[model samples]
Target chain A: MSNTRMIELIGVQKSFGTLQVLKDISLTVDKGAVVALIGPSGSGKSTLLRSINLLTVPNSGYIRVGDHAMDFSSTQTLPRDRDLAAFRARTGMVFQGFNLFPHMTVEQNVMEGPVTVLGTPKAEARELALALLAKVGLADKAGMRPDSLSGGQKQRVAIARALAMKPDVMLFDEATSALDPELVGEVLAVIRSLAAEGMTMLLVTHEMAFARDVADRVVFMRDGCVVEEGDARQVIEQPSHPATQAFLSHFHNGLA
Target chain B: MQYQWDFGFLLQYKALIGVGVLYTIGFTIATAVSGLVVGCLVALLRLSHLRAATWVVTAFIEVFRCTPVLVQLVWCYYALPMLTGLELTPATAAFLTLTLYGASFYGEIIRGGIISVDLGQWDAGRALGMRRSQLMRRVVLPQALRRMVPPLVNQTVLQLKNTSLLSVLAVPDLLYQGQLITSASYRPLETYTMIAVIYFAILFPLTRLAHRLEARPGH
Candidate 1:
């Protein structure tokens, strides 16, 4: 493992019954780097993102964060509920659907994780939540419920909720896929600013332009394995792999 | 036909009607409040993670739902005291039967409310690191209750009508009192009409309120 690497995976494998979803996936994320995973639907982009937080455990893999390696496949290994819980505190994830608690006000949704997960005092958590909402430019909508917000604003609140935990690394699992076309740009801009601020991110996104513009590196995947990996500029233009070349050509020219 | 309808006899027994309406109103309110508490607890148990608790609550719901309220009322009023050697007056038996009957119906209503809530709400609560109890209190139940309002009002109306059945236990509720008045005055048509009018007055406003709540946005 490199000294500056924030996440390291070795021979990570996952399966659903007899069907394999992730096959011998090994990757490294350097500190403060944005890595974009892009591929066709059902190519395991979301699975790869979820596996980092153990939301979807791998069948056989060694996942290392900072200096700690948590083995997911061992039947004998036991990580207590609290231990797994504490581990999740360091990673923030934004879902495709903007899964805000409908019962809570926008401000309460952001404050929830800090107070419940981290046991921060209510007053302190409230302050931190407000600051995060301000960062996403949703401070004025704090008193409203998520149902009242536009799609773009809801996604921003979801982003603020994830950031409230003060995570070291953030994962975006197709965060803009469910949004309307016009709403996509606002969410993308917020994510772009996070990258500019040196936040480590692993995004599973369909936005080719975003991957090209903001990602330090891009991994092109097919059949649950990365077929081509390189700098975003090289992969998006002048790709070496036939799969990558064919996939990109389809979207660019309306011919698959 | 009733000896020229004996309109003055109707006027004479008006006090009895007033007291009867009070008893009916009091019983309905008390039972509805207690039934809500019973229903919520049983619903939670029915959805319990433990198999034993789930089975127990499921059996309870099934038994109460399938049996007629009349039979249950009679059993509670007559058989319970014999079996347990604990004597209860007619009012106590009527209250217990109402509580049990209302609970089963309300349990179904509450379960439907909980299920109608979006699945993502549960996932969001888990992601926020809320415990099962906290998730229910802060996220799931609030949304469920909001969705439950109309159905709860319907259940309460049904319960108010069901209170008339308690007359069999000689609880001196509205219908029982009405029967006593009619027997003395021999004016069933006039007495029953008054009782019906009183029930309409209580239920109509609640029905309208439920409709108004349902019409609101995000309801």
Candidate 2:
């Protein structure tokens, strides 16, 4: 497999008013690598994942994903809206809420990105959307509205919608966190298959076992910074940092 | 002699009433189309990040909505010609007032509809690499427009009724034509009753349609 830097964030910082969400964050993911970000709620894991696509631009930092790059501190070289749109196309985001255009059918939701952003022809986009929906195991539901889908099914469609763009990297912000316990499995299975196929993904997830199994590396975050990171097995099973150990204890006790 | 009934005279005035009805319907449709266009522009300006532009639109809506539509019609019909030295026919002045008046309400309804959409929808659009305009045209407008249907229909009915204000300017709208017939034939009771019936005939169905739209938001 050809390996190059797929994503890089250097000295990235984000704040909403006085509350800093991402503080001096620096990370890099090689092409085709999956990095799982695990943390307690409000620890900024999701914020960091969102910043990858400039969904929430950092207050100050340098970010580079593929050919797109931005130095937030520079006054003159700020990326234009078109540049940001192109960059976001390169790094697709799947939200926890699904956020599918409710007025559209499942097929339209899946095909929307390509038709509008890439200007792909209707026939080609339709074919790709159907294939992606099939990949997510919801090919039969393509004609239905988002309101009719199960929570897990909606998230899967959202994943397929993001994938339809054929992005260079995918970001999932707690994709399965909102699903009913019974429904979580189906969505995870699809994500697991994506991992198995060597898709580059960065996910903020609460499903510790799924992360450990699927992610090549896990980064534990606390209070807007990465406290620890290593190979997924080493980090999740035996942590060297006290913050990581403390955070894992809650999950360990609950699961055990 | 029982004050001789005069339903017979209306037969002679049917052409006038026909032209009047035509003008009424024409004014309503014209106001609606132009109002929608103006409303969208003002609504976008109100929602924009520009503080000064939003304040100006806010003032415009506030001014239109606070006063009676009569005040606006009178101003456009009377004061505007003096101040701007621009001449307008009485019917055109009525059209101008009705359009601006309807636009203020339309702008509010549109702004409300757009704001009510789930905030997460914007995130979905942005994440997909769509531009701001594409996001609005494709995602946000479709959902927002569905929700806006009831309010928009309600505004249309109200606007239709407000067109009667044109009678004051003697623009030969339905009410003005009825007044002319009543004066010429001295059959005020029958003439005004017929006018009332005609107004109800035009507007009652529209009100019912608005009710139906309100009841079934999915439509």
Candidate 3:
């Protein structure tokens, strides 16, 4: 029974000046569902993921994440400090570039969110950070700086940092896109493990095989609109919409 | 005519030069600390989104950068005491003037350092739910501080040497001590030469340190 909604966005609309990035969109992910959002370049997949965390605010929307609901519309009282913080704490994000704080050790990068935002005591935060590093297979490298790590390892540390906040939902925006081809497997392994553990996650990715295997739901978007969505096998294997077929054909044709 | 190189006078006047060294070192330390602190505050304000504050900081930086430090020091000595009704000593006036002047240069250097950091770093921190202030302290400031170090040391070295201008007020600094010895002992060459050597001695090491800092790029 899909009893709980981990994330829900209704009638979300976002535009940058005259360029609309998300056009009247509604999406929902149930608790423990792994949703993979796939699209061609300029299809607004990244922008849509960012809006769920309010990293990019939708011009008009009703966003419900776990327990907090925010309305972004004219005449509404905008989110206050505590409201924004509460909203953000519910969502954790991993980026395309693996933006770890270079001056900090891997452990410190992971500990930052808990200590500063959640006010977790230092000793406890350190312990949690170490454990998360181990989970990402970087516990041995926890004392090292981000600049010293490989791109894949740095991305893993970023994953640990976001997870340290114990967020209700995790967002990945092309998290593996910046890694070397050989380095991609390690990061993908970590995400595959997260999916196995039933973490409610929304990932924007280009790896067709990995998305087909790991995601329970596959959402295909093009030109700022949801073109097709269904069970992962159906959408990835038997796409019906002309736009979705063209997009997947392009991906399989080495255009990714 | 044979010119005499006299080493004897320095031995007799070592105590005067000692006092001068103490004063110069004191001014450098005081100015470096106070100027750096105030400069950081000003840089923060200038980089802030407050439009009026940015304009005010722009005027402040330009005025200080455009004018001569010597003129500013003289003004602090002569005009400030009369206007504020506070009895001013020359040493205090010079310190205050030098610090304010140094702050402007330091502010510009720090602003450059801040601007040099990657915008992607800011976005990354915010994506992880960090507030703007948290992102700055945790992510941005650390990288910027590394870039600021060489320029900061250069400013300090300049301030240390600039303190010699205090000699114009007959302040007990190295140049003033040299002048007093020149008048009393009738040995301008020995006194001024000693002062020049001392200035070079202090500044050369700092110059080399700046080069070393420049050599070590970001890790």
Candidate 4:
């Protein structure tokens, strides 16, 4: 693993019973690189994204992020809970449903990771949380509960919550897929800003235009395998693979 | 011929009835608290990955739930001493039986509440690098506690009513004192009517509180 490689997966394979979801998947993400993973519905995009943080543990694989590494095939016992938690603490994840803690205020939700996991003092965590919330354009919503926010506002809070952990890499699994068409822009704007700040991110997104504009590279997966991967503009505008061409045809007219 | 109603004789036994009321309320509060603690432990055990612990807790819940509270009180008071060779006073036996009986139902209610929280919420917490205990304390319990309030209150109310069965064990609860009043005064109608009134007075408000909690918005 090179110093520039922020995330590396080697011969990762995951299966659910008889059906394999990730087939010998090997990919590398460089530091400060934004990779957009796009594909059809059942193409294992979300599973692959979730595997990075060990949320959906692969059947047999090697996954390394930063200094933490786990090889599922080599170990008789699964990684200890403490080790897994420590590893996951290094990566931030945002979900499609905006799974914000409904019981806590937006500010508390953002402060939770730092105060609980990192053991940062409450006052310092509060300041950091406020800054993150402000960055997400939710400064006024600090005291409000998540259930009170709109889909767009909730997603922004979710983003702020994840970013509060100061993770090395951010994983967004269909972050904007569950939002209203009108609400998509606000969330996409936050992600776009994160990319501009050179945050290493892997996004499983259906937003073709947003991916084309913000991603440094595009990876196309189908049936648990990457069919095509190249420069974002090159792959989106002029595909070398026939499968990529067919997939891009559907979104051609919808591209903005 | 008209039956003349007389409530005047009961005034002489006011002090005794007052003591009975205090005993009943005390038992309810003590047992409710103990039951809740035991229930939480039971629920956690059931939720754990340990197959043996889960089976043991499930059996405990089933035994208490399937048997009648009256039978449980009798068995604890009478049969328990025979098996364990430790004699128990009426109050001790009643308290023990009620606490365990209440725990069985409370455990199920608490487990249901915890599981009712969305799977995504657990994922969200896990993704943030929270351990299972941290997720339960910081994420799952806070939300589950809201949905648990009404049922928990309702269960406590049932517990209060169940205290009436303590009379069979010769415990000096409200209903036991009422039986004494009936035998002494030879006025079963008035004594039973007054007992019913007192129970209603205590339970009506609690049931109302439960309803209000159930109707409360944003749960």
- Measured by DockQ, the strongest candidate is 2
Local distance difference test, each candidate: 0.85, 0.90, 0.88, 0.94
Ranking by lDDT: 4, 2, 3, 1
Q: If you assessed candidate 2 against the hidden native complex, which CAPRI class would it receive?
A: high
Query: Ten residues in a row with the worst lDDT in model 3 chain B?
Result: B210-219
Off by over 4 Å in 2: A1-3, A76-78, A254-256, B1-8, B215-219
- For model 4, how does the per-residue alpha-carbon lDDT over B123-210 read when each residue is reduced to its tens digit? 8999899988898999999889889999999999999999999999998999999999999989999998999999999899999988
By the lDDT metric, which is better: model 1 or model 4?
Answer: 4
When summed lDDT is taken over every stretch of 10 residues in candidate 3 chain A, the lowest stretch is A74-83
What ranking of all candidate models by TM-score puts the best one first?
A: 4, 2, 3, 1
Pairs that collide, model 1: none
User: A1-256, model 1: which lDDT tens digit per residue?
Assistant: 6779998888888889988889989899999999999888878878888888777778888887665568866664545555555566678888898889877899999998888777899999999999999999999999999999998999999999989988888889889999999999999999999999999999998888888889999999888898899998789877899999988876664221
Per-residue lDDT tens digits of candidate 2, residues A143-184? 999999999999999999999999889999999988999999
- Which candidate achieves the best TM-score against the true structure? 4
Candidate 2 fnat reads 0.90
Per-model DockQ:
0.30, 0.81, 0.43, 0.76
Better structure of 1 and 2 per TM-score: 2
Worst 10 residues of 2 chain A by lDDT: A72-81
For the predicted complex of model 2, DockQ is 0.81
lDDT of 2 by residue, B115-200 (tens): 98898999999999988899899988988987898889889988987888899999888888998998898899888888888888
Instruction: Judging by DockQ, tell me the better candidate of 2 and 4.
Output: 2
Runs of candidate 4 with Cα error greater than 4 angstroms are: B217-219
The sequence of per-residue lDDT tens digits that candidate 4 reaches over residues A1-256 is 6989999999888999999999989999999999999999999999999999999988888999988899998766778888888889999999999889988899999999998898999999999999999999999999998988999999999999999999999999999999999999999999999998989999999899989999999999999999999899889999899988988899999785
Task: Please report, as a value between 0 and 1, the fraction of native contacts recovered by candidate 4.
Answer: 0.71
